[model samples]
Target: MKILLLTLGLGLVCGLQGLDNSAKGSPKLDGKWFTVALASNVTSKIEEGGSLRIFVYNIRVYDGFLTADFFKRENGKCIPFSVTAITKEDGSNLVHYDGLNDFSLESFDDEYSIFMLYNIKDGEVTIWGELFGRTPDLPDEIKKKFEEICERFGIGKDQIRDLYNDDRCEKLR
Candidate 1:
């Protein structure tokens, strides 16, 4: 009887350990994503400091949001973002908002671009869209560079989209 009870206790402990691990490493639905543009490019042409930029899409689940900001990097320092507003929305929702540090990738020639990433929590999913833009359109070469960044981040649009549900749509206009 004692041995049986010990075995049951150990089994329960092991089962719970497995459950805990899976819970913490919960994969985000937006785990893999892509960046379509940069923010500075969109803001430069606008005289208004309130220039809007940056849009992320969850080509997988078809939902996400972007809050704009101006990002600046100093010598030997991490890029700093200045969030300008508090835009809020429901999950999988897409809305245009301003208030973030500008990510200026001058190499791209587009008036707009995107950073796509998703947040997965408790098996629930939400997409995040980081939008960037410029006065000029993004050159093909620069566009490729942006794609490279997405690939490096494990957010390649092709690979993830292939695995995600096919019903998703591109929300950015």
Candidate 2:
């Protein structure tokens, strides 16, 4: 009984520590962001008028979760959308939107970030490579980096789309 009590106490302490750490939030990832480019194994998902072609306004991280606010152009109208992902203990993010999305931060800095999203819906799996920048326009080198990352994920350059000039959702931005 004493051993069990000690183990329980330790577990509670560890859990609290984790919660406190998570509360500090992902500072580097919390800020205004724009969708610079998108690549997907499923080509249609990143094509024009595709559901994955979204313009991000900002991202907020808090309480072990990250929330993104963005706009999606549908039927010639801009529609606002928000997605929240819980940060797992292992530093992964899980989102439930239109499907179960497992997002992993491939690389990030203050100015740019690349995220890989694995989505499973209706027994179909799709991989998405998303590139975001602090500004709408990204340098050629940054775009090259995104291309390299996409190549690593089996997404060819042809599958990538540059959304820098896409202003359909600019009003919402």
Candidate 3:
């Protein structure tokens, strides 16, 4: 009985170690990402109609910290802004940009994730999200996952916008 219990304990430890190693190898959110889809329920001047009107992000990860340059689309224009994305805690996969306009990571996979952006002021909270991918397009499976996230967040299907094939920012690259 003692030998069997020891074997079980070793197996559990090995399983946990393998899980941790696999997580380390998961895709890192470091690249030039384009917005593929978006959804939100926030109503503010910044988030007019609760949608990300125009945006693409070039994110760089440095020692677990994140910084990004935003290319905002407007009136047939792509405006630019630079900001730092802060990791909320040690060993936590989520990162965020905390400011007048806050952006946070809700979840991620190999090609894309549901990124949430929000603004809170005057005791009001306004949240928006974008499906950001390394490229302009996402695989069908990834797209489905993003849709699921939107649904779980109570964002209507109609409210989701697909920015995947929009190549307006090609010149910026």
**Model number with the top lDDT:** 2
lDDT per residue as tens, model 3, 56-164? 6677766545667776666666667766744332222222333244444667756775665544445454456678887788888887777676676566666666765
Model 3 sits at a Cα RMSD from the real structure of: 10.9
lDDT of each residue in 1-173, candidate 1, tens digit only: 44532332232211111112124454332222333343222233121222222222322221222233332223423232322221222112222233222121112222444444323333322323243334223456655665565554444444221112111122321
Ranking by TM-score: 2, 3, 1
Candidate 3 — which pairs collide?
none
Against the reference, the lDDT scores of all candidates come to 0.30, 0.74, 0.57
Instruction: Point out the worst 10-residue segment of candidate 3 by lDDT.
Output: 12-21
What are the per-residue Cα lDDT tens digits for candidate 2 across 32-81? 89999989999887787876777788887676667899888788888898
Ranking by lDDT: 2, 3, 1
> So what's the TM-score on candidate 1?
0.26
Better of 1 and 3 by lDDT: 3
